[model samples]
Target: MLLYGSTDSGHSYKIRAFLLLTASPHAYQWIDLALPQSHRLAAFVAASKFGEVPVLLDQGQAMCQSNAILMYLAQRVGKLAGAETEWQGVLEWLSWESNRIGFSLPNLRYALRWSAQPPEVLHYLRQRVLADLARLDAAVSAQDFLLPSGPSIADLSCSAYLFWLDQVGIDESAYPHLQRWLARLRALPHWQHPDLAMQAVAPDTSLARDE
Candidate 1:
């Protein structure tokens, strides 16, 4: 299996973290987003339907989108898939993460770290992130993971970006339960920081193609 991604992307980290935690065998190819699309690996550009990172090539198939890739990995490994009874709930949480924390957190992080946004835009993102964090804290307050069955892809999906909360100046203290949940995830065997989990591979100029 081959996974294509960028190190700084939380979306990409989601798949990398899962692969690491499950001890799954896969080769990771780092696509330097700083380069123009024309200079990216031809195979990656062809495989990525949306022209984005976190594209997984396996069994002669290319899987795009982070949440979809998570679901595929869970099903393939038969681990971290949640209980069959809770499958619907797992899907719901994944959807929620995509729409909620997934939307607010990454954008906020990007605006703060990579590029500057207008003050009003920054305020809106901060507010959305706070609300999403509160919702997550409340959800996990009574349980150790998102689903009662224990850690699933939903937990992995939602928690990936939160690891870099400090980058966006979000105070972790405000969400104790969320913090604890993150700590629990860290305790998982084979867990590594996102940066370490998805290291960059030297770009293969041979694979470069025109856009």
Candidate 2:
């Protein structure tokens, strides 16, 4: 198996973290999207029709979309679903991660870190992120992980972008539960910092660009 992704991509890191957590062995191919003509490469487009990072190549099959990949890996490893209702809860949190935390927080980081978005735009995005963060805090406050069964794909999916909150000046002090949840994840035996775990041959400095 070969996992195609960029080191700077949160989406890619989500998949990488899961593979590590499961002790799944696979080779990683770094895709430098910042390079000129990278998107136009026939090989890359064949692996990723949408010209995105984090495509998992299993045998001859290519998988796209981060959350979709998470679900696939979870099922493959028998870690995502337990009880029918618990599986449903995992799916629910997966949707929330993609729609709420996944979209807002990463964009906010991009705007703050690399983009030239106007001050008003940044402010608007920040407010939205705070709301999403508050909701996430509330959801995870009652337990160590999203569901009673313990850490599932939902936790990894949501935490991808969140681990970088400090880089964007987002304060974790307001959400102690979320912070505790992150600490628990870090303590996992196979866990590694995304930057150290996912290494690209060449870093994409232009990752903040809206794709």
Candidate 3:
């Protein structure tokens, strides 16, 4: 298997984290949109929906989209993303993660990074972000894990953003369940990506406290 991605992207981090955690012995090939590369070639474009990072080539077939790639690997390894016995919490949480975590939270982070929006709009978005965090803190506090009482794609999916939000000075400690859950995820050996630690992306404490 060949994984093509950029180092600075959170979506790319998802795939990288799984590779470490699951100990999948696959070759990782990285590409950068910041440079002129074949990652934008017709062949690569044919393999993905948006020609974005986190595209996987498994057995010579290409798969794009980070969540899709994670799910595929999970099913193959008989893990979180694969076959579940029922229409239960796993599906619900997985779906929730795709939108609630992957899209909204990540976008907020990016917006803050390049926030040309009016100050009022940025403030509003921050409030929305806080609300989302509270909801997630509540959900995780209600259960030990998102599904089946252990790690799942849902946990990977959701926690990645929660951890990211925490890095951004979102003050996740107010959510006891979330803080504990984050500690558990952080404790995993596979999460030891040298360049991807919260310290690397954590919001500047000085800047965050100014508000």
lDDT for each candidate structure: 0.90, 0.81, 0.65
Question: Residue-pair clashes per candidate, as listed?
Answer: 0, 0, 1
Give per-residue CA lDDT, model 1, range 57-143, as digits (tens). Answer: 888889999999999999999989999999999899999999999999999999998899999999999999999999999999999
Please give the RMSD of candidate 3 to the true structure: 9.1
The runs of at least 3 residues in candidate 1 whose Cα sits more than 4 Å from the true structure, single-residue gaps closed, are 202-211
Task: Give the per-residue lDDT of model 2 (tens digit) for 173-197.
Answer: 7799988989989998799888887
Runs in model 2 lying further than 4 Å from the true structure: 38-42, 201-211
Candidates 1 and 2 compared by lDDT, better number: 1
Model 2, poorest ten-residue lDDT window? 202-211
Please name the candidate that would achieve the greatest TM-score relative to the true structure. Answer: 1
TM-scores of the models, in the order given? 0.94, 0.90, 0.79
Instruction: Report the CA-based lDDT of candidate 1 relative to the real structure.
Output: 0.90
Candidate 3 runs further than 4 Å off: 36-46, 81-83, 86-88, 197-211
Q: Kindly state the number of residue pairs that clash in model 3.
A: 1
List clashing residue pairs in candidate 2.
none
